[model samples]
Structure formats: structure tokens, C-alpha cells
Target: MKKVVLITGASSGLGKSIGEFLHEKGYTVYGTSRNPDKITDSVFRLLQLEVRDVESINNAVAKLLAAEGRIDVLVNNAGVGILGPLEEIPTDEIRNNFETNLFGPIEVMKAVLPQMRIQKSGLIINITSIAGYMGLPYRSVYSASKGALEYVTEALRMEVKPFGIEVTNVAPGEFATNIAAHRYHVRVSQASPYGAYAKTIEVINSQVGGGDDPALMGGAIYKIINTPKPNIHYKVGPFLSRFSIVLKRILPDKMYEKMLMNHYKL
Candidate 1:
């Protein structure tokens, strides 16, 4: 039987790329967006789902199972990006980022585990970030949120091993997407303490626009889905982006910190 795959936040960006790629490979693909009514051009079915809301998550899963009977793969790609100095970012924004980036994926996993356990096989790919591997200067919360999910993937994968469910994280460094436009950016002020943060934001947006194509992530996801035993962590992006993670492991803490500071020109 063709596998049934569900991807959250698939209205656009990397999520849409994955859905389209998997659909072409003959899988039954269902993607979710907060407002499905507005998304009409996707190759796969689009359902209404809000990661921040448990009711919306449960409802979307129920509708999928009722229609497809089994959900073999899930891509928890629903997340938000937050950019600003830690001290300047509002507490509520931090909480909201966790709600979408960390808690959201966990709840989706909870909703799917029962069915996956019954089927005796399933795969979950949580879209994290390379920044999660190391704390970025101004994007501390974004790093923390993605970093927390990485650990969640580590813990949940082991816990669900006996039930035949596989959970893993795929951290994408940067991709050519409209993510720059959607990020929760705290408006910079001329007199703010972290005035340099405005420059950091500009650098970030420039990199995002120049990042690897989303199709590359789609290709990477396809390979992971077909693997009999997927690793706990995978990353997709340009060479420098992926290499940065390796450097962090081998470089001294202060040296790595200096490199980051110099790169962001902080």
C-alpha cells in the first residue's frame, strides 16, 4: 500500500516542497495550514490546523485518519521564526514561539502515536534549525525553541522505539523562502541598547534570501523517508551551513563564540 504522509504548515516554504515531492513519489499527502480555504494550488490535500491549538491539531488528525485510515509519516514543519535581542524581545513573543516551534510538534506527536503504535510502524520528522545546535546572538529564543525540539526528538525516539514509531529532527540551515517576511521582528529603535541588532537582522534576511533552494530540502526529506532506519538528527542546507555544526563540535567554546560574533558583526 502507498504510505500516507501528513505535513503541517504545508501551505508554503519547505513544507510545501516536501509535500509536493512526496506526492510525486506516489504517497497520499495531506498538508495543513491555519486557513486551508485560502490555499487552493497545492498538489496535496490541505486541511485546517493550528499548531498552537490542541483542538485544531486533534481535529486535523481525525479528519486525515477518517479519510486515509493510516498515517505512515508525519512532518512537523509548523514553526515560527523570532528575531531580536533577548532582552528586547517581549516575553509573550517568546512563549508564542515555543508554542509554535516546540510545544506544537510535541502535541502533534501525541495525537499520532496511538495510530502509529497500532500500525506498528511510523516515522516523524521534526523540522528544527542549525542555529539550534548553537545559540545565535540575537536569535537566542529561536535557537532555544529549535534546540528544545532537537532534545525532544532525542528523547521521544527512544521512548517510542518499542512501539515501532521513529522520531527524528531535520534542521535546515537556511532556505530561499519568504520566511524573512514572516519572522516576528521586534522593531529596532535608534536608542535601544542592542542597536547593532538592526544590522544582524539585515544580515539574517540577506542570508535567508540567498540560502539553498527549498527543493533541496524536499529531496533530503525523500531520502530520509525511504531509509529503513533514519538517524535521530539530520540537517539540510548549503555546505557552510552544515559545516558550521561540525565546527561547533570541535572548536573551543570561546573560539566558536568569537567566530559567531564576527560573522554577525555584533
Candidate 2:
């Protein structure tokens, strides 16, 4: 029997790449996006879904279940990134980020667990970020969201292991994607005094211009899906990402802060 894989946030970026790769590998792939009308992929079936909405999730799951009868893999790739100083970023924007990045995946997991439990076999892959393991200057809220997701992935892995269900978290560092292009709802105020960091912020945003390719992340996802026993967390990207994770673990807090300040020339 062919396995069925459902991927959210499949309109573009790593999610779209994973959908295409898995579909070619013989899995029945269902790619989801908020603007379903925009998704006209002949490679995989596209379903309309917004991970932040419960009703949207339920409807998408019903449509897939009715057609496929079972879901073997659930890829929760829907997320948003909001970058700015913590004090400057609006509280509502932070809440919205959590809704889409952390709670959204938890909602999808809830909607799919019943079916996976009944089947006694399944895999859940959550697309987190290397930011989940370490913090950065202007991405406080985004980092917190991914950190919460990492915790959820760890808890779910142990909770569902007895049922023969596998949970994997994919943490990719600075991938080339339109996430920075379509950065939703970033409000900057000239009234604020922290304007000195404006140029630094611009430089950081510009660096996102030539990050790692999204295809590499897609290939990493493919490998994790096919591995006999995948690790709880898989980090993808350049060597610097690995080094950053290690530095976070070993470096003193003040020294780490100084290092980041110097690296960004802040």
C-alpha cells in the first residue's frame, strides 16, 4: 500500500520542495496552503488550509481522509517569521507569530493523531529552525516560537513512541525563501529611539538574500523520512549553524552575547 503524506504551507519554500520530492518517491502527497486558488501544482494534490484555524484544519483533513482513508505522514511546515527588537515589536504580532508557528503545528498534530493511533503506524515531521536552539538579535519572538515547537516535538516523540508513531523536528538555518520577502505585518515607528539599530537591521535582512538553498532542506527531509530510526532533531544548513549550536551550549552567557554583538557589529 502506498503511504499518504500531508504537507502544510506548501505554496512555496521548503514545504513545496518536500511535497514535490515525496510525491516523486511514490507517496500520495497532499500539499496545503492558505491561498488554495494559487496552488495549481500538477505534481501533487493541493488543499486549502490555514494552520492557525481549527476549522480550516478539520476541513482539509476530512477531504484527505475521505479520499485516501489514511494518513501515514504529517509534515507541519506552516510558519511565519517576524523580525525586530523585542521591545519595539507589538504584542499582537508576537501572539500572531505563536499562533502560526507553535500552536498551528500542535493543532494539526491533534487533528491527525486519532487516525495515526488507530493505524498503529505513522510519522510526524515538524519544520522548526536552528533559531529554536539559539537566540539571535532581532528575532526574539520568532526564536521563542521555534523554541516552543522544539519542546513540543520532544514531548510528542516520547508520548507517541509506544504507539509506533515517530516524530522528527527539522531545524534549518537561514534558507533561501520568500519568507523574508512576504514578511507579514512588520511595523516600524520613527518615534522610537532605538533607531540606531536600523542600519544593522537592514544589513541582517540583506544577508538573508544569499542563504542556503531550499532544495538542500527538502533533501534532508527526504532522508529523515526514509531513515530507519530518525533522530528527534535534524539540523540542516551551513557549518556555522552547527558551531552556533555548540557555542550556545559551552560559551558563557555574557561572552556569547558579546560574540553576537561583535559579529553583527551592533
Candidate 3:
């Protein structure tokens, strides 16, 4: 029997790429999108899933379980991003960020765990960010959201290990995707002191525009799933971004912060 794979936020970007690539590899791939109409892949089944909505999540999972006897891989690629100074950002927006990026995945994991536990085999991959490794300027909330998710994945890996369930956090450094269009910019006043950093937006945008192809990410994930035993964390992206994870570990606190600032030209 073919392995069953379900990916959230599969309308486009890395999620869509992964779905399409895995489908080509002969996995039974089911993808979820907030606007089901946005999923254009003919080979992949699109399920209506608004990760922020509990009912939508439950219904989607139920439908998948009904159609497929089991889901071998669950990729939590559904996430939203916010950009701005933490102090100026709205509380509701912060909550919205966490709701989609953190809580949404947690809820989905809860819904799938029982079935996975009973089967004694499953792989859960959470798509986090390099920002999680080091909080970036003007993207504090985005970094915090991913950081928290990574921490949760750490604990979850241990908890699920005994049941033959594998949990991995795949942190992509940067990719050329529609993520720029989805990033919410916190409204900042002209009088705000932090307004000077507004130029960082363009810098970040340029970085993303030149980032690596997401097809590479799909290949990385494919290899991960096929591995007999995978590690708890994997960083997929450009060499520098992947190296940043190591640099952060060996460098002193202030030196690492300065390196990040210099990278963004802060």
C-alpha cells in the first residue's frame, strides 16, 4: 500500500510544492487550503481547512481518516507571519499569528495522535523558521511564534517516540514564495521611534526574493520521510542560513546578535 501524506496550507509555496512532488513520487497526497478553490493541482486532493477554526480542522481530519485508512505523514505547513516592533503590534494580531502558526498545528496533532498511536507508525513534520533560531529585527512576533512551536516539537518528539511516531521540526531559512503577500505589517505611527527601521522591510523582501527554490525543500522532506530514523530537527535552506544554526550555538550572545544585525544591515 502507498503511504498517505497530508499537508496543510497547500494552496501554494512550499506546501504545494511538497504535495506535488510527493504525489509524483507515488504517495497518496491530500492537501488543505483555507480557500479550497486556490488549490489547482489536479493530482492532489484539496480539503477545505482553516487551521484557525477548530471545527474546520476536526472536519478535515475526519474526512481524511474516512477516505484513507491511515495517514503516514502529517506536515504542519499552515502558518501566518506578522512584521513589526513587538510593542507596537496589536495583541489580536499576535494572537492570530500564534493561532495559525502554533495552536493550529497543536490541535491538528492532538486530533491525529490517537489514530497514529494505535497504528504504531506515523511521522509529523512541523514547518518552523530560521527566525526561530534567532529573533530577527522587526519580526519579533513571527520569530516568537516559530520559537514556541519548535520548543513544543522538542517535547512532542520525546512523548511520541515510544509509540513509533516520529516528530520533526523542519525550519526553512528563506524561500521565494507568496509569503511576502501574507505577512501582516503592524501599523506603526510616524511618531514612533522605531519607525526608522521601516527600510528593513525592503531588505527582508529582497532576501526572500533571492532565496532558494522550494523544490529543494520538497526533496529534503521526501528524503526525511523515507529515512528509517530521522532526527528531531532539520534546517533546509541556503548554506549561510543553515550555517547560522551552528554559528548561533558556538558564538557568544552579543556576537551572535551583532551578526544577525549585520546580515540585515541594521
Candidate 4:
């Protein structure tokens, strides 16, 4: 039987790329979007999924199982970006960010685990970011959300290992995607000292637009799922960006902060 795969936020970008690549390899791919009608991919079945909604998440999984009989792999790629100084970002906006980036995937994993446990085999991939490893200047909350998700992935691996379910966090540095368009850009007050760093926003956006191809991440995910045993964390992106992960691990906190601020020219 073809391995069944489910990917969230598959309307475009990395999620769509992953779904398309896996479908080409004969996996029965089911993808989710907030608006299924907007998913133009004919190669995979698309389902309407509002990740923040419990009913929507549970129903999507149920619908997929009804059609495919099993869900062999899940890529939790659904997430939103909130850009601004943490103090200036609205409370609701921060909550919504976590709701989508952190809680959403956890709930989805909860919904899928029973079947995965029953089968004694399954793979769960959580899409995080290099920013998660080190907090970015204006995108503090976005970093926090992804960082929290990484911790969740770490704890979850131990909990689910005995059941034969595997979990890994995929941290991508910069990728060309529509995510930049949807980012919640905060208007910094001129009087606030952080206002000077506002220009960094435009710089960040430019980097994202010129970043690595989404197909690279798709290819990485494909290899990850097929590996007999995968590492707990996989970082993908341009060489310098992926190398930052190692730098963050070895450098002192102050030195790392200096390097990060210098990179953004803050």
C-alpha cells in the first residue's frame, strides 16, 4: 500500500511543495488549507482545515482516514508570522500566533496519534525556523512561537517513541513564500527607541523573497521521512543560515547576540 501523508497549510510554499513531491513518489497525499477551494494542486486531495479550531483539525483527520485508511506521515507546516517589537505587538496577535504555530500542531498530533500508535509506525515533522534557535530583533513573538514548538517536538519524541511514532523539527532559515505578505507588521512609534530597527523589517522581507527555493525543503522532507531513523532536528536553508545553528550552540549568549544584531545591522 502507498504510504498515506497529510500536510497542513498546503495552499502554497513549502507545504505545497512537500505534498507535490511526495505525491510524485506514489504517496497518497492529502493536504489542508483554510480555503480548500484555493488549493489549485490537482495531484493531491485538499481539505479545509482551520488549524486553530479543534473541530476543523479533528474532522480533517477523520475525513482523511476515511478516504485513505491510514495516515503514515504528518507534516505540521501550518504557521503564521508576527513581525514587531514584542512589547508593541498586540496581545491578541501574539496569542493567535501561538494558537496557529504551536498549539495547532500539538492538537493535530493528538488527533493523529491514536491511529499511529495502533499501526506502530508513523512520522511527524514540525516546521520551525532558525529564528527559533535565536530570537530575531523585530520578530520576537514569531521566534517565541517557533521556539516553543521546537521544545514541544523534543518532549513529544520521548513520549511517543514507545508507540513507534517519530517526531522531528525541521527548521528552515529563509524560503521564498507568501508568508511575508501575511505577516502582521507592527507600526513602531517614532519616539520608541526600537523605531530605528523598523528598517530591518524591509531588510528581512527582502531576504525572504530572495531566499532558498521551497523545493529544497520538500526534497529534504522526503529524505527525512524515508530514512530508517531520523535525527531530532534538521535545519535546511542557505549554508550561512544553517551554520548559524552551530554558532548559536557554541557561542556565548552575549557574543551570539552581537553576531545576530550585526547580521541584521541593528
Q: Cα lDDT of model 4 overall?
A: 0.91
**Which of the two candidates, 1 or 2, achieves a greater lDDT against the reference?**
1
Residue 163's lDDT in candidate 2: 92
- Kindly report which residue stretches of model 2 are placed more than 4 angstroms away from their true locations once superposed: 185-187
Flag the better candidate by TM-score, 2 or 3.
Answer: 3
For each candidate in the order shown, give its overall lDDT on alpha carbons: 0.94, 0.86, 0.90, 0.91
Candidate 2, residues 70-153, lDDT tens digits: the string is: 999999999988888788788998999999999999999999999999999899999998988877777888889999999999
Regions more than 4 Å wrong, model 1? none
How well does candidate 1 score on lDDT at residue 67?
98
Q: What is candidate 3's CA lDDT for residue 184?
A: 95
The TM-score obtained by model 4 is: 0.97
Candidate 1 RMSD to the real structure: 0.7
Q: Which candidate, 1 or 4, would have the higher TM-score against the true structure?
A: 1
TM-score, candidate 1, is 0.99
Better of 2 and 3 by lDDT: 3
Model 3, residue 115: what's the lDDT?
88
Taking the tens digit of each residue's C-alpha lDDT, what string does model 4 give over 182-242? Answer: 8787887778768656678878988999999998888999999989888999999988889
Using lDDT, give the best candidate's number: 1
How well does model 2 score by local distance difference test? Answer: 0.86
Candidates by lDDT, descending order? 1, 4, 3, 2
